[model samples]
Target: MSRKIKVLQLQNRYNVNASDLAEQVIQGLPAERFEVTTAFLRGRPGPGEPESRAARSIYFGFSQSDLKGLRLRALWRLYRLWREQRYDVVIAHRFKPMNMLMLLNRCLRIPACIGVQHGIGDFDRAYRRWEARRLLTANWRIVGVSRAVRDYLVGCGAGFDAGNTVQINNAIDIDRAERLQHPREQARSLLGLAREPFIFGAIGRLVPVKGHIHLIEAFAQVQSVYPQAQLAIIGEGRMRAELEAAIARFGLGGKVQLLGAREDALQYVRAFDAFVMPSLSEGLPLALLEGMSGHLPVIGSDIPSLRPILEDCGGRIFPVGDVATLAKQLGAVLNLDAEQRRAEGERAYSYLRGAHAIEDFRLQYLQLIEQSLAAERAAL
Candidate 1:
């Protein structure tokens, strides 16, 4: 019998979507032909660190200085780990891990390297862009979470080999999402939400990119049309104080609530009458997918990353960062009858079932891994 191919998955942090994707990929691989381990490259666990499920897990415990500066020490530690493991293939999530893996791969001729880009418009630095082009060579592949991201990288002169670069949308565990979800009224009761209010909900970090302030502005306009409307943004970030001030400034203190981070936040999505994400940027946002998995009518920024999903799934879209347009969309959605809303939600769920099933995502990655290894052997 052929020996199993040993693999390693690396990410800079543990709680985010990248980690989640890595975990899913690890779990989904064929057990007989693949053996997988996982690692994190940075500081200690945060409040949101996911439960580890890899066959083995490692942490570099990088300090603040290591993360802020050139990260030379971290690189050294990674090099040692790579040397020790001698993995047949290394899969990296996000830029930091990808860049570091490239450096190591170039120096030591790592057998195979795969990088997954999880966000759109994330490369803003000239050096970072240059690095991407420089690092993509033989035995290396970059996977984009959306077609838009792959196109952007290729167009921007990232040296991704045309055959090697690919687009794979993020997938949610549909069964798990369904199991976790509560009925609308029960979910609302869990959150102490009144049954009378029309709740429009969003879940994500409270960062500038999420465009929560704009969502607030739009919700304010929504209130003018439907006084009983309430907006609840779940998740927390650096922008909390700023968003709070804006909510007060707009006199929406009574209608808008920032619920901060909750471990079970996705389960409560059922409480929303409709879901919204006003992100300025994204790469197939998992939050949006989770919302859709709950069969909620979604409203999202009409950027390239989200437009296709919204278009395919029967959801509403507004121009990015446009508060007025978002408000208009929200008002129009509110005008829909109960049957229309249910139809919209059903459409989203149906689209997800066909287009972004977890099994398809896993199969694609497995094929990529096998093909990459085959190419490496052919080159030899």
Candidate 2:
């Protein structure tokens, strides 16, 4: 019988989306052929510890605030663990964890490393671009969560081997998403929202990159024509003060509300007349998927990261960061009759189910691992 391949999944922190993807990957792998463990490169576990669903989990203590100090501490600690376990593969998600694994591979000559690029914006920094070109050297493969990210990495001269760089989009749980959604009336009641107002909802971090300011601006414009319209933004971030000021500046105090972060946020998706994501950048956002899964017609920025999904799922798109265009799109959707809006949403859900199945995502990762392992053996 063939020995089971032991794999380690690493991430900088256990944020919701990253953790979810890691858990799905671990859960989906064939038990007889693979064993998986997960580790976080920074931060201590909160309330319920070891959030990832792996056979085993570990935490490597290193402060994110101190880059030089982190390198010394993480490198020493990871080396000790790598020598002891001798894992067959180490799949690192996001930039910091990937960079750490690449450095470790260079020094200790340990396991085969896989770097997963969950997004694309990080390379904007000179230091990150330099590190990308200099550090990644080993038996390694890099997976981008979207085609745009893969193209961006190669365009930046990151020196990733042409043959090994690839794209595997983040997958969604269509069944779970559909089950989580409540009926429109019940969902509104659950959130203490009134049904009379035409709700335009958005869920994302309130950071500048999310373009909440622009969304708020666009919604204010939509209010000029559709006075009954209200905007509800879920999630919290450092930009609250600025966003609040924008609301006041536009005199949308009563019309717009920052709902903040809610654990049950996705359940309330159906409460909205339509869902929108005004992100300036993204790599297959999970919120968009959940919105579609709830059968809400979507409106999003026409950035490369979102085009593939919007084009397939049949949503309205506006130019990135253009408030007037977004307002125009919002007005167009709001003008649709209930039946017309429902039909658009149904089309989106059908496309989402057909294209982004969680099982297919799992199978692709498994195949990648198997091929990587086989290539390694053949080389020897």
Candidate 3:
């Protein structure tokens, strides 16, 4: 009997969405043909948090300082772990872990190495590009979570090209996501929201990149025209104070609500009348996909990552960081009747089912792994 292929999936930290994505990779591979191990360089699952679902899991417990600068000690520990396990394939997520493996794999000579890029501008530094160009070999492959990210990698002159880079859109398990969501009336009650308002909801960190300020500004204009219009932002961050100040400045205390971070935030999405994602940038946001899975009419920025998905799915898009345009789009969605809005949302759900289904994501990843292994065998 052929020996099962051993795989290592390394992540910098334990994040809810990222862990779920890794779980998909673990479950996608056939048990008879492969064994997978997942490792986190820092942080572990806290109480009530989900843990890795790989056949085996490891937590390095490295502090922030350990991974900074040259990361010599971290590298030594990872090298020892790699040599001991002797994995047939190594999959690293994001920049730090990928950079570490890129350097270590040169000495360990892993048969196949896959680096997953979750966002853009990760290779903006000259040194990172130089390292990638020098250390990458025929055994290496880079995956971008979205086509925009793939294009950025290929165009950055950082050793990644069309042949070495592939686009795999981030996906959610639709059945599980939808099942977790509460009914509209129940969800609104859970969020302490009134059923009377036409709520425009958003889910993301309250960071500048999320463009919440612009959303608030636009909503300020929106409420003046449609006094019943309300905005609810879910999630908390350092920007809370700034966002609160803006809410005060607009005198929108009752209209704009910052519903601080809540666990399983997606479960309450039904509380929204329409979903909005005004991100300044993204690498195929899973939140948007989650919103669509709830069958909500969505609006997003005109940035490359969101434009194609929104346009293709029959959702709305406005110029990034343009408050005036964002307000205009919000008003447009408000103009739609209940039936028209439901139809628009159904179109998005249909598009998501066809394009970003978990089954397709799993198949594509499995195919990539098998092809990478076959190429390694040929090289030998």
Candidate 4:
């Protein structure tokens, strides 16, 4: 902790989870104690924004697919740049270059290397056999955002040191989400929602793994009984045309709206009676945490990572693709008495603030960073 930690996060370029987390970390850091710098694989900060106090935010690639052919080329460029700089520590995030960095770290002896697990990916992830084996056979420290993920690594025999695998839940900034002081009616009208129907919403990039199609079908079943409840999904994804077509096919056009990703994610959440995340997989979803922070009780798919987080809140969980069960859970929650619903929202919000607020997460990052640095020096 004596030297200013210079962290080089090899994460995504589109400013999603990793970038968003980095931004909050900069804003929340005890500036006097930390100096941060970054190297991403995409776009630059826009228009003189001081998002990071680092000397610069360098881009190595702009899109996920861009890394395929030029990965080695990108690493050669990054290594040259890194060689000129002396870093106290380097924490590489997920995949490609990060994996590449960890694989080559022994040769560099970069002092300390940390790898953050984004999720307990599906069976398909076994393809990273060499990298997984390298982690088991090498000296890198591993961190998972949720305990479920940590357990998965241990079960897989990833060979992390006994104490090297740490569980750090992703954090949320409750204050940011709390800004939605607008009345529910106002939120509904603003989002072009009917003034009186029950609103059920979910947010995430519209990918197949997100389980959006199942949610659409589940909501359709729920509307059969209430006819007054509506589902609004907020996110931008390649599946828009297909999702829209599915909604029409279900004859739920009047009951569902696909509000593609928005500037303020909570704005749409504020209009919901309850939020839903039917993800087949996740890394401690930010959407569920944010929705709950906004005091919207949630219904999630029963996945290993999300189950433990939701079970305590009277959160309802159904089988991954069970439309009947999912619809039943949604209907039951929406049918609660006004006081009961308010109490549930309050409980959900309290759970979020207690365990997952943004400030809490920022502090956790600093602690982990400082701890990793200390561990290195202690060994010396």
Candidate 5:
């Protein structure tokens, strides 16, 4: 009998939604043909936090300082682990873990090394691009979590051309997401929201990149026309003070609420009458996908990563960071009657089912891994 291929899935940290794609890699690969081990370079899962589902899991527990600068100690430790395990394939997520593996694999010669880029501008630095160009080999493959990310990598002059790069849209477990969601009434109650107001919802870090300020500006305009309209945002970040200031500036103190970071935020998605994502940039946001899974009419900025998804799903899209356009889109959704809004939401869910289904996501990853292994065997 052929020996099972051993694989390592490396990530920088364990975050709730951010880590789900790596976990999907673990769950996607068939057990009979492969054995997968997951490693976190910095932190371990906290209580009630989801852990890796790989056959085996390791937590490096390195501090932030350890991974900065030359990352000598981290590199040495990872090198020791790689030598001991002699993994047939290594899949590294994001930049740090991917860079470390690229450096070490140059010597260890891991048969197949896959680096997954979750966002754009990762290779903006000259040194990082030089390192990638120098260290990457025939067995190395780069995967972008979205088509925009793939294009960014290919155009970045970092040795990631069309030949070595592939696009794999991020996905979520639709069944699990739908099952975990609270019913609309229960979700609203949990969020301290009154059912009378039409709530426009968003879930993301309150950062400049997320464009929460712009979302607030747009909602301020919408609320003036429709006093019944309210806005609620989930998640916390350094920009909390700034976002609060914006709310105060608009005199939306009671009408708009920053719910702050809630664990399992997807559960409360049903509380929203309509979902909005006004991100300035993204590499295929899973929150927007989760919102669609909730069967809610959606609105988003027309950035490259979000445009196709929203357009295809029949969701409203405004130009990125354009508050007037965003407000216009929000008002358009507000204008829809209950049945019309439901139909629009159903269109989104149908598109999600056909395009971003977890089954298709898993099959694509499995095929990529198998093809990488097959290429290695052919070369040998």
Candidate 6:
């Protein structure tokens, strides 16, 4: 390669999760090996901002409207941007950029165009079909955060080269998260959470697919068994009103609090006795990993993506959308003796550091880029 691998990261403003992970990866990479620049479909202030500084150029556009209109404007702006700018590689997050990326890469001939799947959640049929077409392109790499996603694409009968897909699980710096364990009492004191409450927390957008509602239902079941419990959900989304209503309907207003996007969430991760993700669909969620890294016992929905991460890590896995099953599992896990839960947490940490190590994952990504770029140069 003649120059540093200049990767142009394309993202939507609403893609808070993907952007956060991308930025962290960029910052975490060896500086001499890469140059990461970003272009946001609609940029706003949120958790993904600070670490995105590695990007030599940052392009911000796109405004949040309903999903459909946002898609339209994103397509137009992206094509224009591709025509105007130059990049060695383009890494896009979300469906919009992926849809037009083929044409843009064809026009620009960027050696690498990688797509990062941030989550396993999806919308209606039209959206799924649209996603398939958006991701179809030659010499493109699709990094599915979970094996389920990689398999989904293959099963859907998309006409792309089968080998083009890669399963790159989302990873985090667990060392930092381990340090977040400053003393459970101290973390609780900082968050003003009850030092004695058996606090359970979920961090992510409170959308339907996130299955926050399901978690709430499970918590309701849990409350019947353990009275000294409270649920703290971190992050905001469209389902705020609905979720708030659910909390009240269950008469859990006092027991449940929707804390929107905490700045010191990792630090506060220590306060929670358990980290719950009742998501219906996911692509190896980062929150689950963070939860495990913080040594919080994980209780995840039993799904392909989730099972691969949580099943054997002393993390309890339950069936997706089966409220009764999730509730049963939740009650059982939450009721474990303190020592048993702590031992489970230790197991989770060891598994996370081994399978989802940041250094290994990052190196894999870098290797992909290097090999791809090398092949391109050889062809040239």
How do the residues 1-380 of candidate 2 rate in per-residue lDDT, one tens digit apiece?
Answer: 98888998987875534428877878778888887888877665688644666777786766765446457767778878888888999898987778878877877665467889877776788877787777766478898877677887767667765687877777787777768788989988877778789999999989998999999999989898899999989899999999999999999987888888887578889989899999998875888988888888999998878877898889999999999999999999999999999999999988878777788788888888888878777777
In candidate 1, residue 207 scores what lDDT?
97
Q: lDDT per residue, candidate 1, 1-380, as tens digits?
A: 99889899998875544327777787778888888888887644667655567778787777667866577888888888878878899999988788888888888787788999887665777777788777767899889887677877666666765687898878888888888888989988888777888899999999999999899999998897799899998999999999999999989987998888977688899999999999998765888888888998999998888888889888999999999999999999899998999999999999988878787888889989998999999899
| Cα misplacement distance, residue 145 of candidate 5 (Å) | 0.7
Q: Assess candidate 3 and give its lDDT.
A: 0.90
Q: Which ten residues in a row have the lowest lDDT in candidate 1?
A: 14-23
lDDT of 6 by residue, 1-380 (tens): 56765677777663344326666656655678677777666655555354256646454544556235445555656666656655677877766566557555656677777877655544225655665666465567877766667666555544434678787766777776676556888977876677888888898887888999988988888887788889988889999999999999998977998988776477678878889898887765878888887887889888778887776576888888888888887787777899998998899989888878777777777777777777678878
Each prediction's Cα lDDT score?
0.85, 0.83, 0.90, 0.74, 0.89, 0.74
- The local distance difference test score of model 6 is 0.74
* Candidate 1 lDDT (Cα, 0 to 1): 0.85
Tens digits of per-residue lDDT, candidate 3, 324-354, equal 9999999999999999999998999999998
For model 5, what is the alpha-carbon lDDT of residue 76?
Answer: 96
Question: Model 3: clashing residue pairs?
Answer: none
Question: Clashes per prediction?
Answer: 0, 1, 0, 5, 0, 6
Q: When superposed on Cα atoms, how far off is each prediction in RMSD? A: 2.5, 2.4, 1.7, 3.0, 2.1, 3.9
Which of the two candidates, 3 or 4, achieves a greater lDDT against the reference?
3
Error of 3 at 269 (Å): 1.3
Name the regions of candidate 1 deviating beyond 4 angstroms.
16-19, 46-51, 67-70, 122-124
- List, residue by residue over 122-173, the lDDT tens digit for candidate 5: 8999988998999989898899887778888999989999888998888878
Pairs in clash, predicted candidate 5: none
Clashes of 4: 5
Which one is best on TM-score? Answer: 3
- Candidate 1 residue pairs in clash (backbone atoms < 3 Å): none
> How many steric clashes does model 5 contain?
0
- Higher-lDDT candidate of 3 and 6: 3
